[model samples]
Target: MAWKFRRRVKVIPGVHLNFSKSGISTSIGVKGASVTLGSSGAYLNTSIPGLGIYNTVVRPG
Candidate 1:
């Protein structure tokens, strides 16, 4: 079996918030958690307590 190494990239430190008549969004990331809203939908990505990482996405039906 081959072993692979993953590189960690540092995210810009700060909290971001956006508000509009259509929708509302917010994100806070220092070292771990990250979130955003895109054309497809909104998503939150973060590291779980035990699990490696968790990602959730929500879109309109």
Candidate 2:
């Protein structure tokens, strides 16, 4: 087996963006809120009424 030599080139400028799935949490931070998830499922159990995001919990009760 033979390997071919490739030239290294810098990325183009303009149109700044990122593409990666290494560690991107889908759920955003829910500060001052009570949100939880579990093997059963995830739910937004807040008496705040129409709460968007607050916090995340492993075992929600």
Candidate 3:
């Protein structure tokens, strides 16, 4: 079994800070679209709030 720890704090209306065992990440956007930049890398995230459909793509550096 593996254990994971993660916490998220909303900085503002469309901004958030994520904390985890790996490191920290900043997420910016609304419910359906967002971008995350962190120690690991950058990512583009999109989703439909009610449809349970979502996608994440790695942003090329």
Q: What TM-score quantifies how close candidate 1 is to the native fold?
A: 0.35
Q: lDDT by residue for model 3 over 15-56, one digit each (tens)? A: 999999999999999999999999878999999999999999
- Off-target runs (Cα >4 Å) in candidate 2 are 1-32, 48-61
lDDT of 2 by residue, 1-61 (tens): 9654433222343211222332211222233443333344444434444665444345433
1-61: candidate 1 lDDT, tens digit per residue: 9665433333445666655444555566644566666454666666675666776556542
Predict model 2's lDDT versus the native: 0.34
* Global lDDT of each candidate: 0.57, 0.34, 0.95
lDDT of 1 at 10: 35
RMSD after CA superposition, every candidate = 10.0, 15.6, 1.1
Q: Which pairs clash inside model 2?
A: 30-54, 33-54
Question: Which ranges of candidate 1 are over 4 A from the true structure?
Answer: 1-12, 15-28, 48-51, 57-61
The TM-score leader among the candidates is: 3
TM-score of each: 0.35, 0.23, 0.92
Sort by TM-score, best first.
3, 1, 2
Error of 1 at 18 (Å): 16
- Give the CA lDDT, 0 to 100, for residue 30 in model 3: 94
